[model samples]
Target: MILSIGCSEPLTTREKGAVYGTLGGAGLGAIIGSATGNAGAGAGIGAAVGLLGGALIGDQMQQRQNQDAAVQRQLSTQQAEIERQQRELEQLRRQQAR
Candidate 1:
C-alpha cells in the first residue's frame, strides 16, 4: 500500500556511509592482509577503518548530492519562467491579429 511504502524509511547518511565503509574496508583489508600473511587481522582492521572512512565519505557525498539537487531545482524554476514568458508572448501576438 502507499502508506506502507511511505512508512519504509530510507537509510540515514551515516548508515549508508558505514555500509560503504565496511564493504570497501573489507575488500582492501583482505587484499592487504593476504599479501602480508595476516588476512584475518587485515580484514578486521580494514572493516574498522573502512567504517570510519566510509562515514566521512558518505557525509561528504550526501552534502554534494544536496547541493546538486538545489541547483537542479533552480534550473527547473528558470526553465518554467522562460516557458511562461514564451506563452505570454505568443498570446499577445494572437491578440494583435484580432
Candidate 2:
C-alpha cells in the first residue's frame, strides 16, 4: 500500500548547519558590500567566505556528533555486560543456597 523512494538517509545536522550558514553569511556580506558601492565583488567574496566557514563549522559539528554516538554505544555495551554479570552472580548465589 505504500511506496518507497531512493536514499532514505536524511541530511545530518552538520550539513544543514553548513548550508544555512553559507546562505546567511553570503547575504549579509553582499548587503554590507553594497553600501561601499560594489555589489558584485561583495557578493562573490561573501559567498566564498560563507561557504568556507559554513563547511568548517558543519564538519566540526559532525565530528562532535560522531564522538557522542561512540560514547553512547560504549555505555550501552558496558551496561549490557554489567547486567550479564549480575545475572550470572544471581545464578551462582542460588546454587550455593541449594
Candidate 3:
C-alpha cells in the first residue's frame, strides 16, 4: 500500500502528513495498548488523533507556502512597476535636457 503511494502521483502535503501520522500513531498505540491489554482501541484512537493533528499542521504549512508565493508575485509586480517608472523618469530628463 505504501509502495503504491510512492509510485503514484505525489500527494499533497496534507495527505503525506496524515499518512505518516497515522502510521506512526498506530504503531505506537499498538505497542502501548498491548502492554495494557487494549491494543485495538488504542490503535484506533491514536490513528484518529494523529490524522487530525497532522492535517492541521499540514494545512498551516500549505497556507504559509501560498502566502509566500503571493508575496513573491507581488514583489515581482512592484519591481516591474519601479523599473517602468525609472525608465519614464530617464526619458523625461532627456527631453528636458534637449
Candidate 4:
C-alpha cells in the first residue's frame, strides 16, 4: 500500500507580523477616533497614518521574500552541481568496469 500526504506552505515571520500589525492598527485607529470629538478628521488622519505604516511593513515583507529567493537560488545551484558530479563519477566507474 502506498500513502500520500499533502503539506501546506508555512507563513513566514514577516507575513505573520504584517497581518497582526494591520489588525492592531485598525483597532487603534477606531479607538482613537471614537475617543476624540473629531471622529471624521481623526479617521482620515488615522487612515493615512495606517496606510503609510502598512506600506512600510509590506515593504519589509517584500525584502524578506527577496532574501529567501536569493537563498533558494544558491541552494538550487549547489544541488545541480552535486548532481553533475555524481553523474560524472558514475560514468568514470562504468568506464573502468568495461
lDDT of each: 0.87, 0.79, 0.84, 0.69
Where does candidate 1 stray beyond 4 Å? 1-8, 12-14, 27-41
How would the candidate models be sorted by lDDT, starting from the highest? 1, 3, 2, 4
Model 2 global lDDT (CA atoms, 0 to 1): 0.79
Encode model 3's per-residue lDDT on 25-44: one tens digit a residue: 88788888888999998898
Q: Mind giving the per-residue lDDT tens digits that candidate 1 earns over 1-98?
A: 22234546877676688787887898899999999999989999999999999888888888888999999999999999999999999999999999
Q: Which one wins by TM-score: 2 or 3?
A: 2
lDDT tens digits, residue span 57-80, model 4: 877877988999999999999999
Using all chains and alpha carbons, the TM-scores for the candidates as numbered come to 0.69, 0.83, 0.77, 0.68
Give per-residue CA lDDT, model 2, range 1-98, as digits (tens). Answer: 01113326666666666666667777887898899998777877887888788878888989999999999999999999999999999999999999
Highest lDDT among the candidates is held by which one?
1
lDDT for model 3 comes to 0.84
Number of the top-ranking candidate, with TM-score as the measure: 2
Candidate number with the higher lDDT (3 or 4): 3
lDDT-better candidate, 2 vs 3: 3
